[model samples]
Target chain A: MSKRVALEASHACCEAVRMADTDVVAAYPITPQTHVPERLAEMVADGELDAEYIPVESEHSAMSACCGASAVGARAFTTTAGVGLELMHEVVYIASSMRYPIVMVICNRALSAPLSVWCDHSDVMSVRDTGWIQVFCQNNQEAFDMTLWAFRVGEDPKVLFPVMVHFDGFTLSHVTEAMFLPEQEEVDRFLPKKRQYQFALDPDKPMTHGAFGPPDMYTESKISQEVAFRKSKELIIQGWKEFGKIFGRYYYPVEPYRAEGAKTMLLMMGSLNETAKLVVDRKREKGESVGLINLRLWRPFPFEELRQAVKDAETIVVFDRCISFGGPGGPVFSEVRSALYGMERMPKVVGFVGGLGGRDVPIKDIEYAFDRGREVAEKGSEEIFETVGVRGKVEGIREPKGVYLPAK
Target chain B: MATKARKTKAAVKKLRTASEVTWRDMEVGGILTDAGSAALRRTGDWRSERPILDKEKCNKCGLCWLYCPDAAVDACEDGYYEVNLYSCKGCGICAEICPKEAITMIEEEEE
Candidate 1:
């Protein structure tokens, strides 16, 4: 039996980590990700959870320590947000390429420049190509459930890649929500005590990991990694199915919310999906054909599921929390567009970048997005993307500002 | 202990050169299961210069053997040090470290 309790999303993640029986917790303190490791440290100190908690000075060392622990066949875990993730950018790739199976919780926060410790997808988007199995959590319950699922899927003999469970900072991480916490015995049954890491660092069977590969071997090595990564999707779905059987809460790569027979759809990821769902409900009540598609899995992207979900919709308004600077719209929008390309019948993808740096996305902004998206789909706009609720006017400068010419 | 040594030797024997192996042949995470597998990789082809030994001027101090980074220098039965061309990378460390100045680095003619 599972107990229902109100917990801050960060603490909920800690509880899941505790139940997972992680061997090592190595992380640096970064907001709003600080509460997760902080609570885990207290649990370790109280002897409630027996694990080695290494309070590293930097996020780079934190991830490096996780690599070491995972290499030695330890179930390692870590948490970071925004700039802390950028600080450990290089090691993040190392953790995946080495197939460490280290689980991480990213409290998604905006990047620096303006310097805000708030919720956004900027941090998570930067590490999109790091080769980790990435997933987004819509609420505290999903956050807790996915952390456990991460360990199970990642540590499976078939899929040894690292996993990153991302939730919006402050919005999901700091907010208190009622979630069901499963019993220890139930979690143990789901994720067995024995871990099968074939290439673990053991003295009895000596082996070399992370060997230098010259040009002759580098491409083949990457091809092997890619093959394994693509194959992990099957096990990921299996893990979720098994978890649902035990926990009664099922999850999917691309989840639909009242998307049946709708002409216009709203696509979103992370905590904002709940708000979008509410908007979808209100639109449906008004006899408007609106639906919501929540992208749960980010890496090993749910391309087939996403296409299937939006196949009937005439237009898809992709609301991205992070911008791609000068590139085509947002990162999610560009990928979604590319995924829908070459199809016989494809919907118009209207991208909007908003809710940046913890800015509140009011119900009216979402409503405007739907209206604007419909209008844009009917009559095309010259702009690549439009910012939602931004208060500014721009003057166009078509020519170069400064130029230097060599003497003739 | 004997079985373990034999198992490692068997793994080493089964190991294929980089050009011969495909992605499917690679171990999980590209881990090399056999220990001391580096000894099987011949790095001697990287050499542009070869080390030559002057036997009469050599003091047989074993400095070349000690200083050779690749362990390419070997001691003969007659106490003379000879460079093993199969493993030498032409780093010239043996020539640089010899006190008697009996070792010389000569540029190799293109094959």
Candidate 2:
């Protein structure tokens, strides 16, 4: 029997890492993400978990160490938040390109200006093109569950790319929740000892890694990497199915909630999906033709599944916690729109950017967004992207005297 | 028992271009089977100026051998060291480092 315990979600993730029998945990603690490494350190100190717990100097070194560890066939893991993710941005690209199966849990936090350490999807969006498989979690249970699943999927021989498991900082990271922590024996059975890399760094077999490819070979190198990543989606589905069979909890790349026979659907990722689901339920109760599409998989972008999820809908309102600045819409919205671009009966996609810098995107704001999206769809508006929950109208906000603005 | 693995030397004699590369040359995780494949590339082709050795004036002090970055200077059957045009990049480091003034940089004749 599995143990049922109430624990902080961050600790739950740490427990998952322990139960997964991760060989190395190298990370520098950032707020909301600190509890994970902190508990891992305690577990290592108490001799409960036998692993190399490297307290790295910075996020860059943390990721670099993980790259090194994973390259040597160790089941490496790490956790970071906000600026830490940005600091390790360069290594993030290398890790995926080199095909290191390092599992990372990012307690997704808002990026800084007026620095805020709170929940948002901004950090992960910044590295959206890093080629690592990214997954967002809705609650503590999912965070814990995905931590285990990440190692299984990432370490699969067919898919050797790194994986990022994103859970909302503060919201899911700090909140205590009751969930069943799987037994060590079950977890061991589910995830056998990590198999050795076919071309691992070994003294006996000398080989070079991360070599410079000239112009002639660079294109093929990139094509090969992308083909491997795209093909990993099949292995990801397979891995999830295998996990479901053992654990009795199923998950999908894009999960639909009351989306069938609905005209307008709300799309969201991370913990915000829970909030959107509530509004979907409320709207359904009042006979409103509204539903929700929760994006569980963020990378390999789930292009086909996303299109299939909203195929029946007339309007799709995508809630983005991070804006794309000069682009057509938020990151999620841009990807969603691009995914549905060539369809014969494409849904009117509305991009709504809110909950930035950790601001609470209340249930009312989401309801308003759905209604406004429906109105925009009915009107056939050319402009479909807008910001929500931003304070007081900006009629007279000006750039500094020295800063020149380009004439629009 | 840490012996280094070596591929057939005859295969390293000629430089192979990207078009000559086949899928069989590709490895699972970018592994380089032949560790120092740079030797397979005739970097002497990149040389604008070649180093001409005056064997009579050469003292065989071995300074040129020490200074050659690519280790292109091979010790002859006699005491003198000769440049192997197959691998020499003609960096002029050997000419600059030769105390006996036995090496001269001249325009490389293209085939």
Candidate 3:
């Protein structure tokens, strides 16, 4: 038989991870995330699961242990946040380049200067280029669902890269939601036994993994990697489609919240989009035309899908939680702008960077985003601008609004 | 609750111990150093051990590369062992087999 229980989002994610049947889990303890591995430890102790749990010293060693275990043909799992993610940064690249299917959970938190362990995209944004397929979970249910799916998607032979599931720190990590725990047998049916890993070990079969690729072959290797990433989007969709078939839930690359009409729109990722959705709802109730685009896929960025979503809107507002610093707006915001660059009827995009280090971006402030959008659509504005949050000069910056994208 | 756990554990322990004919063999079980080179010299596990001359030591003899089982020693910009950490596996074949004796199979420093 199976069971259902009320647990925090972190615990819900762990429950699915428990059901996913990892063979080996190597992780070091870090906050807001400690509960996750702690529960797994209890599961192992009770003999509820047969697995090897290796607890190492630091995040680097944690990932090092993960690489070592994954190398020898075991399904590995780990979780971390903020500086823990930073410490594992070097090995993150190795995991992806080597194409070992290690899955991790990043309970999103802000990096510290004076020390903060609160919700922010700064940590996840910093490591986006490490080439791991990253996914944002809107709530605890998605957190639980995506954690199981990440393993399935990541371990697919076509997409053998590691994956990171990001959920807002303290906010979602501590926030509880009613999640439907699937039967373990269903998960077993969904994710079958892994193909025997051909890692380097057997004397009979000598093999080389992660040997330095020379310049002559390195370019082609990267092209193949990009091709794999393109292949991953289809794999991600297939994983989701299969998941929806079993669990009665569906997901899209760019989950359009309410962009049916509305001349103006807001594009954002993570839970902030939830806040943006409520703002759009209240505005719609007042007979206003405003919508939201909650992007689910960041890397293997769904550029073509996003452009098609926004082509009809007259004005676009992108609320970025992490800034690109010295570049055109935030990283995702810049990508969205470039994706629309060639479109003949691209919306006048206004980029706003806010919610750094877990600052509040009230729904009222989101209204200001629409107000700015109205200014652009009405005045034919070219001011590419940013929003100043509750914190000012000392802790916040309101970037100027204008078009920095190359002309369409 | 015990469920005869002790007996199984002791049996497992005994089985594990019995499998190892030599404790020393178990210690060196996973770590292979010189065996890599001997294996590559598939010609009856016997090849003329050639000495590699570290460029700084050699008068540009080009000797070992000429008399090598394989063209394994590659010259880099600065003098350093381009030991293909892959195939070479620190076999000491290049170093022990080096005429200069500059190549010694010191145990690889644990990274």
Candidate 4:
């Protein structure tokens, strides 16, 4: 029988790791993500989980230790947020490109200039190209579920690449919610005991890891890495399906809520999906043609799944908490547009950057953004980028008062 | 300097050149087969200059062998030390360390 417990999302992650019997937990402290390692350390100290808890000095050292541990055929794990993730940026690439199968939990936080430690997607967006399998969680239960699933997906013989499971900083990490914690025996049955790596850094059979490739072989080396990552999608599906069979809670790469036959849809990620689901329900009650699409899989992007979900919709209002600065619209909006390209019929994609630097994007703001997107689609407007719920007005701003204008 | 060449042979592993490598040989995750296999790679092409030896002035002090960074210097049966041109980087370290002043660094002649 599964144990029902009320746990903060961060602590739930630690519980999941403990249940999975992770071999190593290496991490440094940062806001919103600190509770995870703290609980993990307590578990290791109290003899609850027999694992090496490496209390690293910096996030860089944490990731490096994870790389070393995973390379030596151990199941390594770590957690970080915002600046800490940025500090470990270089090693993040090394971990994935080397295919270490290190699992990481990221408490997504806003980046600093004014230095606010709050919930946002800037941190994970910054490292999107690092080649790690990245996923987002909407609530505490999903956070707990994904943490276990990450280990299974990453350590599969076919997919030896690293995996990162992200949940919003204070939004999910600090909030307490009821979750079903599976028994250790159940987890052990679901996740394999044998740790299989493409190349083990074992003493008996000596091998080189992260070897320096000359210009002659660098391109081919990257091509091989890409092919391996693309192929991992099959194993990811199989792993999740197997987890569902045991746990009774299934998950999808691109999960849709009330999206059937809706003319207009709101697309977002992380905890905002829960808020958007509420707004979708309210809109439906009022007989509005609106729905919601939660993008759970960010890397090894579910392009085909996403295209199928939004095919019938007339407009897609993509809410991006992170900005692309000088480029087109927001980061998630760019991906959605790119995914819709070459399709016979595509929805009019509109971008709304909001909730930056920990600002609250209330349900009303989301409704307004959706209405604006519907208006834009009806008008057939070429300009489709806007920022939701900004305080003061800017000079010479048009219809949607806070449209993000790229510097001329 | 005369030592018996051992009957038990260690196999010589050659590092594949760019053209010699096939896509199938490229391992996933870029993990290499052998750790520290640089010894299999001949770095002779990195050299711009070659060391010329004056055998008459060579004192057989073995200073060149002691200082050869690439370990290209070998003790000859005739008491003099010779450079294995295939692996010599021609860094001039052997010439710099030679007390007999028998070694000279000269531009490598094109074959």
Q: Return the TM-score for each candidate structure.
A: 0.92, 0.90, 0.76, 0.91
Q: What is the interface RMSD of candidate 2, in Å?
A: 2.4
- CA shift of B80, model 3, Å: 25
DockQ of 2: 0.44
- List the pairs of residues colliding in candidate 4: none
* Residues A1-408, model 2: lDDT tens digits: 778889877998998888888899999999979999999999999988889999899999999999999888899999999999999999999899889999999999988877989878889989999999999999998998999999999988889989999999998899998888887887888897765678778888776888767666666677778888999999999988988888888999999999999999999899988988889899999999998999999998888998888899999998899867667778898899899999989998888888987899889999989998888778855443666787774232222247676989
lDDT of 2 by residue, B1-111 (tens): 112212233555555766676544555455565666655655465678888889889986888877788877767656677777757877899999888888999887743
Clash pairs detected, candidate 2: none
> Residues B1-111, candidate 1, lDDT per residue (tens digit)?
011111223444565656687888878887888987766654576689999999999987889888888767767767787776756899998889889999999998833
Q: How would you encode candidate 4's per-residue C-alpha lDDT over A1-408 as one tens digit per residue? A: 998999999998988898888999999999979899999999999999999999899999999999999988899999999999999999999999888889999999988878979988899889999999999999999999999999999988778889999999988999999889998888988888758765777787888888767666788888888888888888888888999999988988899899999999999999999989999999999999898999999999999999999999988999999977667878999999999988899998888889987789899999888998888777854444777788775222234447696999
Residue pairs whose backbone atoms clash in candidate 1? none
User: After superposition, which runs of candidate 1 have C-alpha atoms over 4 Å from their true positions?
Assistant: A393-408, B1-15, B54-59, B75-87, B108-111
Q: After the best TM-score superposition of candidate 1, give how far the Cα of residue A38 lies from its true spot, in angstroms.
A: 0.6
Q: Name the candidate that leads on lDDT.
A: 1
Better of 3 and 4 by TM-score: 4
Docking class of 1: medium
Candidate 1, residue B59: the lDDT equals 82
Model 4: CA > 4 A from native: A380-384, A394-408, B1-15, B42-60, B72-90, B102-111
Note the chain A TM-score of all models in turn: 0.96, 0.95, 0.91, 0.95
Q: Which candidate is the best by DockQ?
A: 1
Give lDDT: candidate 2, residue A96. 94
Give the CAPRI class of candidate 3: incorrect
